[model samples]
Target chain A: MTAAALPRTTVDRRPPLGGFSLTYLALEIRRVLRNRRSLFFILIMPAVFFLLFGLPQKGQNIDQANSAAAIAYIMISLAVYGAMTASTATGGAVAVERAQGWSRQLRLTPLRPPAYVATKVLSALSLSLLSVLVEFVVGSIGGVRMPAHVWLLAGLGAWLGSLVFAALGLFVGYLAPAENVMQFMGPILALLALFGGLFVPLEVLPHVMRTIAKFTPVYGVGSIARSPLTHDFSWVAVLNVVGWTAFFGLGAALLFRRDTARV
Target chain B: MRTDTLAASETTGTRTPAVLLRGLTKKFGAVTAVNQLDLRIEPGEVVAFLGPNGAGKTTTIDMMLGLARPTQGSVEVYGLAPTEAINQGRIAAVMQTGGLLKDVSVAEIVRMTASFFANTRPVDEVLERAGIADIADRRVAKCSGGQQQRLRFALALLPDPDLMVLDEPTTGMDVEGRRDFWNAIRTDAQAGRTVLFATHYLEEADAYADRIVLIRKGQVVADGTASEVKALAAGRQVRATLPGADEVRLAALPGVDRAEVRGETVLLHTNDSDGVARYLLTQTTARDLEITSRNLEDAFLALTSGEDTDLEGVSR
Candidate 1:
């Protein structure tokens, strides 16, 4: 290690997009994709639930719609659940990265903090999309027959609505210890799914449970997703998704700044 | 844009110091981790920050790398804020530990780090230079501590930074690993890139650093070349064979800083070895008297130990 030339490479200062790069996002995605256990939970678990619950309801039709409508509703609910789980897991993984000091390592690089956050969101969104598509494919195989536009709109709604969970995941990741983050999130998500009417329809439930479900973040997502098929579009669902996104996004940003600002 | 700033400054022919910290203070609740510390490093100097555990070495390094912010004062890297300097790829760091991802292969992490910098050395070259090319395929979780450290070094090298700040860079390495790592760092330092490394190892500071900054209790107690720091804690030890020697009385004697009875022989640490030698030989039936100048270890203890906690006129 002697007589080596100085490292005098020309500086390429491209700060547009705040040092964001697809190469890094690809690597981040690749790491999660390689985790077979997580993939099972994010992609396979929802499909399993859909098969378990939706198959029994395959021959039934409610409100005089097609028999496939009941199965499609279950598929959409599972899709929302799967997409949220995928994104939240990806976002919540930040706690582990923080615990390992990888976050500190990244701060030393040219990658800005905003770029890191953006990469994480993109990475989570990618996995969320995959989770949603996996359910859709399974739904199609299981005789879920919706019009082409409903499939696209419902899939798009489920995938896009998952941005709220992505932010929630990041917030929880930064808030909770790495070991306890998923443990805390798992039960909370299940409860949210139940209260949001993703598990059982609000119609069958008592009046009080139905009233309280509307306030949960998951209810808004479920309404937006089911609106395309049910034709029951409401501005309240949009408010719920947008409001929770801002709330969790703000919380995550504050926690992130605090985490990086101290030892 | 940062390159343009650098090129402009170069044309003016006044080289900016690689790092400049002025009255830097960091407080975590009631504990003041770094207390108004000031340091300046010019380009090409390999300086060592020597301190014991909990002596604010990590905190100071954290502030310099923009991983933590200072509560008071300022840190400038090449005349820019720490984050700005880092964003410009003018500075990089090889932190003590836990920086590499466990599931990722060594090569993959290196490639990922290289992507963060718009201008970086080739990934393979950095891997080879850090001497981790052979283990590049191994997952970080499977790699040994030394291998992980080398991988961290490789990531730092990706940007080809002008200033490298390392916090205990050779912590988990073996003897030979430490030697090889320092050899690589020395080669880099010789090429006019400034390096500041924090370490608790006295020998690392003695052997590698052009200057040593000895810190204790969140303040610098001694700062100079290896020999200069040794000279700062100037003293000598006088040894004599005395049966049933009273260590307390000997320590109370004029010019005797400390005295210890080591079985048959009594060792007296003192500034005035002549006085200690005269007292031991004449006042007692002592024989086989010998005196020696203090080494760096003795100097380290003399300056760093004790509760004086005075912070004035100590630094060079």
Candidate 2:
């Protein structure tokens, strides 16, 4: 065919930035929920942990001088853990999408890059919220005892603290290979949980370990989440969580910029 | 079904070209993928970008679609920037491979992509158009290569784009699949939408494209209608039984480009085979005469293999 045979076409302009359509969010949420393996890792496993550790025992301390009831403390910790797992898991999914060339596909569309990232984060937060809810339910069924105020504070703190992990997930998704993203994230989350006093109370740990735990990002999230249960708010923990959130958020943004600059 | 909408837009009577590249160049470190390419494609023209491996076809297409930033020069689609044109739903592309979520069902993928566009065809209609409605419920990972290609086509159709760019869209498909894919594209093209495709398939360029643009080593070597480009490299062969033929005299004939004596047969290569055949018939006792025109593959090799010829002046 020659160029002379066809009539020329003219440009027709349309509006850009169709302001956060609910359909995009709904579709993303559906995709995340459909992944059963992700659901298990982010929600069910944390619920199981709450059930195992929060059950009231015959001789166990129900309440201590500084801390709230043992069931309530364990419930908050498990819920925070679930939130972190869910957020990071979503980041890992982002890495897999990049590997699959889905980012390239997205670049060709009307959807902007920032909008894509926002959708992923929103869906991740939704899943993390579900994980936290499931853990609370399991804790309730296991005879957790706490005032209504304590329950609300702890739940809100844990859910909000997960933003740090969501940022971390985006960082690792851009940094790590797709197939090994979970492998890279799993041990880090577990170690963070151990050191941050989600698995074992900081008071019971040796003096040196407790000091190091205060420096970990999870330590801030753990301390803040458990403040309602422990009736003690550590300004140091708040500072730590805020600091790490900024660090990870900046790192993820930089990495995403670099990745998109290529291919 | 939405031809009326397309016709209404066309009658707006604006005269912007579908695509225009002026001195477009892209360099990756020391390697240049495309160099000083200038082209203009009018609307509703089905143009084939023909090239060999590493011939800069992909790079040129990448620049055209705004996937890569050019080191020098500019690209405009519908007189708008490439990215702006794409965001406004004026352009869409079907990539060669790996632009899909493997775990999702076909319908889910289509709907997901459709969510990004402000205006879209009905998902079921796109599915039927691409001929993948039967596999709408199946996971993309489970679909065959051809089925996946069709799914990509469905995604491209979501915005009812004015220009569709397909990069090696039929690379992995079998013969029947290639035919079906082109048939779908043809139906869309018949609606007066502009289409640009890059492929190494000679027959595809000859059969599907109204114009052929051949690029080699980061520069366009030839650009014209299929027959015109073919004529640039077209050499015909005339074989006749002329015992004791004077190979020197034959080579020096009016239209003959080369002459060879093969046993009892005298073979003459010429740009004008009919003239040479007439000479052999009327002026000589040439028996068992035959003439054959060179195919597009031969034209391609001839145009691409030589030391960089400045055919940019010849291409219009």
Candidate 2 per-residue lDDT, tens place, A13-80, comes to 23245424667778777777888877888878888877666674423553557534677788889899
Error of 2 at B84 (Å): 1.4
Off by over 4 Å in 2: A1-19, A56-59, A62-64, B1-15, B240-255, B261-265, B275-289, B309-316
Per-candidate RMSD, Å:
6.6, 5.0
Give a tens-digit lDDT track for model 1, residues B62-138.
Answer: 88877788999899988888777787778889988887889899999998888777767898999888898898899
For this target, which candidate reaches the highest TM-score against the unseen true structure?
2
CAPRI class assigned to model 2: acceptable
Per-candidate interface DockQ score? 0.39, 0.48
Worst 10 residues of 2 chain A by lDDT: A1-10
Which runs in model 1 stand beyond 4 Å of their true positions? Answer: A1-15, A63-68, A260-263, B1-15, B237-291, B309-316
Lowest summed lDDT over 10 consecutive residues: which window, candidate 2 chain B?
B1-10
Model 2: residue B107 alpha-carbon error in angstroms: 1.5
The Cα local distance difference test for each model comes to 0.83, 0.83
